[model samples]
Target: MPSPYTVIEIFMTQYRCKRERNARKKFSNVF
Candidate 1:
């Protein structure tokens, strides 16, 4: 089984990916 830390790390990476996508979308609208 995976450790707790590993699960948290995965979740964080996904969250950052989503944030980056949103930022890009907002930027495109401005430009």
Candidate 2:
């Protein structure tokens, strides 16, 4: 299995991508 840190890093990247996508949608709606 992967190390704990590796798992966290992957989770963080996916989470960040999702959050950025959501933020973009909100910004587009506002503009």
Candidate 3:
């Protein structure tokens, strides 16, 4: 059984993780 909310949750989590990683790299370079 598949749920629509599950897919959205996974996608959002991946997007957030990617954004966080990029931000970390940007701040690290600045520091």
Candidate with top lDDT is: 2
lDDT of 2 at 12: 100
Candidate 2 stretches with Cα past 4 Å from truth are none
List, residue by residue over 1-31, the lDDT tens digit for candidate 1: 8999999999999999999999999999999
Report the Cα lDDT for residue 9, model 2: 100
Worst 10 residues of 1 by lDDT: 1-10
Stretches of candidate 3 off by over 4 Å are none
Best by TM-score: 2
Listed in order, each prediction's TM-score against the native is 0.91, 0.92, 0.87
lDDT string, candidate 2, 5-27, tens digits: 99999999999999999999999
lDDT of 3 by residue, 2-28 (tens): 699999999999999999999999999
Q: State candidate 1's TM-score.
A: 0.91
Per-residue error at 5 for model 1, in Å? Answer: 0.3
lDDT of each: 0.99, 1.00, 0.96
- Residue 10 in candidate 1, Cα distance off native in Å: 0.2
